[model samples]
Target: MEGHPPGLETVTLPPYSPELQPVERAWNLTDEPLANRCFESLAEL
Candidate 1:
């Protein structure tokens, strides 16, 4: 199992609109590659 190191603290940031998230936009723009390519095995995926 993994153990956390000493002196760890969580830092919170101000909430931002989802529209500002680049990842979300990228996901929305990109089509599902898995669906387009048929992979029968886990290795292929």
Candidate 2:
């Protein structure tokens, strides 16, 4: 079940697995820089 052209690769995920989703990991990291910081307004944020 593993075949792809040269260096190309494929990924598969099962249904309803938020913990395994890559987007969740990205969101977790995105919050880091804004964690302890305060914003002047919504526009500043």
Candidate 3:
């Protein structure tokens, strides 16, 4: 809460709890290319 205004509380989730994080669900789409193949260069990528 360093950047947030006072009185705003933060809750910490246990490690490895992917179900609690929505972004975890989208990782498959972003990771698919990196997992299936390798790119030789930035242009080819």
Return whichever of 2 and 3 wins on lDDT.
Answer: 3
Q: Which sections of candidate 2 miss by over 4 Å?
A: 1-19
Score candidate 3 by lDDT.
0.90
Candidate that scores best on lDDT: 3
Worst 10 residues of 2 by lDDT: 1-10
- Clashing pairs for model 3 are none
* TM-score attained by model 2: 0.41
The best candidate in terms of TM-score: 3
Candidate 1 lDDT by residue in tens digits, 1-45 = 236577776555459756655577776456566456777899877
Question: For model 2, which pairs clash?
Answer: none
Candidate 1: residue 31 Cα off by (Å): 4.1
Give the alpha carbon lDDT tens digit for every residue of 1-45 in model 2: 357678876778788788887697787678988898999999998
Error of 3 at 17 (Å): 0.8
Evaluated against the true structure, the overall lDDT of model 2 is 0.82
The clash numbers for all candidates, in the given order, read 0, 0, 0
TM-score of each: 0.30, 0.41, 0.58
Name the regions of candidate 1 deviating beyond 4 angstroms: 1-16, 29-31, 36-38
Q: What lDDT tens digits, residue by residue, belong to model 3 across residues 1-45?
A: 598789898899998899999999999988987887888999998
